[model samples]
Target: MKIVDKIGFDEILLQLAEEASELSQAALKLRRARMGINPTPITCEKANLHLLEEIADVTLCFGILNLSDTEFDYIEHTAKKKYRRWKKRLGIDKE
Candidate 1:
């Protein structure tokens, strides 16, 4: 039986969203740790580990969602566009 057959597609989508949110939160925590903003003292090493773990979870969700190479290419293209816009906003690039 296919993986999607065992687990409904809707569930996979939900899981992907949850994992992505978790990854975002992990990134925020890492930033907080680096800036020493949060009262809850956490080691930078632990924060980095947490972020890495969340990234792995999100990557696994992408696999379960059966992302294709074409989808990846589109994502890369969009990311490059966004990166260019970001650099321009920061005055790092003229274009």
Candidate 2:
């Protein structure tokens, strides 16, 4: 958190991009390694934890990005979409 204030706007955006790429990598580890398409020796827990961390990083980046635009509609849409998807997948929804 201390490092957060030390950086500039553009640097934070760059970190956001880098974090996105890391999220992609973590997803690939789950999809490819689990499917036997990749032999990177990744456990599901490890990959999922990495994914969770990457998502946290992206959200932290958004905290900085949101300083520029308070009304970021995409954030709302994405949060709802992801929440719905996860709830459905985890059997947390009535329907």
- What tens-digit string does per-residue lDDT give for candidate 2 at 1-95? 54556787789889999999998888888777677765677787788888899989888987876553436776677889999989999999855
The list of candidate 1 runs beyond 4 A from truth reads none
Q: Candidate 1: what lDDT? A: 0.89
lDDT of each prediction vs. the true structure?
0.89, 0.80
lDDT of 1 by residue, 1-95 (tens): 76667988899899889989999998999898898866447888999999999999988887787878999999999999999999999999997
Q: List the residue pairs that clash in candidate 1.
A: none
